[model samples]
Target: MEAGEDIRWLPRHTVPDDLVFPFGGKDWWLIDDRLLAMGHTEAGRVTGHEIIDAPKGSHEAVALRNALWPLAIPHGEYRP
Candidate 1:
């Protein structure tokens, strides 16, 4: 999405959920109970993707990556 674009989204949960603050950068929070989504138009095409959970805080981004560097999410591994 770009500036001036209107993003429409909804939370995954009906009731308010926990507030997850970003470990770095900003202090935004993510709702634990609600699934999130946003819609936007790009190059004349409308597309959107679901918001997902990031592993807690990314405070140890480098360390986490180094520790699990060998592991990978195989294609279709988590698909229904």
Candidate 2:
């Protein structure tokens, strides 16, 4: 997904055991085949957008956020 794109992860209590793809600059939601909330992330503030559901107790819930943390800001900010 490009910068400033909003997204929602399906399934409020379970983690989807697979890779997710939130492509394009358009906002999208990542839902499992059963249409449940997992996790979500956006480039900017999600005004008026509510993160309905997410993994209740799994580390994978932060997978996308952890991965995207590097891209949150510009280079040299987190450099050693």
Candidate 3:
């Protein structure tokens, strides 16, 4: 965080527990407004990933991430 001027690092621990994730609870990355990269994990271990074309901008993922952004702690402020 010391040098993260242009990037916002929102760590997961500070987010509230009320976020309802889409994509079957799989971890996801909204890679711009065109692609969504989803990771398939089992027992906290990675299995594989799926890259889906999202022409409509991955509305669900975008919403969830936006919702999480404000709720999460900035990387510089997180103690753990």
The 0-to-1 C-alpha lDDT of every candidate, in the order given, reads 0.35, 0.40, 0.68
TM-scores, one per candidate: 0.20, 0.25, 0.64
Q: List the candidate numbers ranked by lDDT, top first.
A: 3, 2, 1
lDDT of 1 at 26: 26
* Candidate number with greatest TM-score: 3
What's each prediction's clash count? 3, 7, 0
Report the lDDT tens digits of candidate 3 across residue range 1-80. 36544224555555557755577777777766458988998899999998988655488767776776766556556665
- Give the per-residue Cα lDDT of candidate 2 at 79: 34
Rank ordering of all candidates by TM-score, starting from the highest: 3, 2, 1
Question: Relative to the unseen true structure, what is the C-alpha lDDT of residue 67 in candidate 1, on a scale of 0 to 100?
Answer: 41
- State model 3's lDDT: 0.68
Instruction: Give the CA lDDT, 0 to 100, for residue 55 in model 2.
Output: 49
Worst 10 residues of 3 by lDDT: 1-10
